[model samples]
Target: MISEPFANKKTWVHSLDPRLRVCTAFFLSCLFAITNQPVLAACALIASALLLGCSRPPLSALLRRLAGVNLFILFLWCSVPFFTPGTPIAKFGPLTCTQEGLDLVWLVTLKANAITLLLIACIGTMSASLLGHALQALRLPDKFVYLLLFTYRSLFVLADEWQRLQTALRLRGFVAGTNLHTYRTVGYLFGLTLTRSLDRAQRIHQAMLLRGFTGRFPAFVLLRFQRHDFLFAILTALFLIFLLFFWNNPFFP
Candidate 1:
């Protein structure tokens, strides 16, 4: 089964309406993506961190997620500074690192971390089903919502099928190696998995039809926008306004 470690937490952040959270995350991600000022990006990162702290997710899981995000940022750090054109700040052999590249990478690092943290604080606090319902409530296209919900459900089935295939391979005395035989065996395994997955999907569709599943899924729990939700929205709006005001006016160069 897929893990939802943060969803079970009973924090104020988790209690907010899922629709509000979804909207906030979407806007924050978009804003941060286009922000170029390092100071503004740093402030956004701090705000995101504070929101994440309010959620109080498990420390280990949070660290693991952040580590995964930074791993990609680390790759950028290794290459971006060398190829960008600007005044040279450092050099090793024939390679040169420039101020412009360093600044650009720093901005990107701050924005990426800020958006990721914001998403975890907002969207990650809810279950997948709740997210789908929230999207529906926000007037997203029915087909898109259906696709999201179905894909989320299918992931668990796929994981189980992959595990079963791996077990069968082990039972047949298959040992992995750096050889053409191993490569061919792995390819066959994937092909068989795909075939089984298609069959399972057909069975699932038939079952859904038998159960009278219409085009839309009825949400069991209705979400309400409470006073606290309004308060949260106001605070987020103010923060966004502040960021916009200082977007190009960095406090410190």
Candidate 2:
């Protein structure tokens, strides 16, 4: 139930201009994607971790976010080593892993960790509503921005509905086991969840129409680029330039 864990923190990251944060994230992501060097990726990941530390969100929240990132990364570790061809490093039964494949795994894991940390540190500080407005200001597609906005709000609503369905099942003495009854009941729950989601979406659309929600969503609080934002921009630019330098340098081999 700890949704949007970083949003409420009274940190300098939270005080940054949402638009600036979004742009920084975009650029950092580009840097991650463009670089093939695992050393550079590892450096970026470390920097991202330090940045996240500065944000000062609760330790539990930090761990939770990292756990989610690593879970997906676990799949990459599992598959990349076996398939990518190079000199064999080790073998498990008949499957052989190569050094090149292991390198690829490192590249993926580092880049993903770097991006996730940066996203949590930068974008996670802002509320979904503010982020939507920021995205609109950045001239991202309206449909995508609105989708992000609605998805953020609706996630909690749908989760609540799911909990209610679980409660209803529990009241009817539903016990989860590997059986036909359990499978049927689980399927029913899924169908009901989908049905409720569709119904809610329809109602939400109608409500928006009634409230004069056109294609454009207006921001109540106008975002201004402040002194701190300027400072952040300067520092971020310097760091990115350093990353560029490192990429071209034959330091780590």
lDDT per residue as tens, model 1, 73-148: 9999999999999999999899999999999999999999999999999999999999999999999999999999
Q: Give me the runs in candidate 2 sitting further than 4 Å from their true place.
A: 75-79, 88-97
* Candidate 1 segments exceeding 4 Å error: 250-253
Give the TM-score of each candidate. 0.95, 0.88
In the range 1-253, model 2's lDDT, one tens digit per residue, is 3378888888778888999999999999889877899888988999899888888888897888889989988998898899988999899987999999999888888998899999988888888888899999989999999888888777877887799999999998889999998999999999898889879889989998999988787788689999999999999999999888887787864
Error of 1 at 45 (Å): 0.2
- Taking all chains together, the TM-score of candidate 2 against the true structure is 0.88
TM-score attained by model 1: 0.95
For all candidates in order, the CA lDDT equals 0.93, 0.88
Ten residues in sequence with the least summed lDDT for candidate 2? 1-10
Q: Listing every candidate in turn, what is its Cα RMSD in Å to the true structure after a full C-alpha superposition? A: 1.4, 2.4
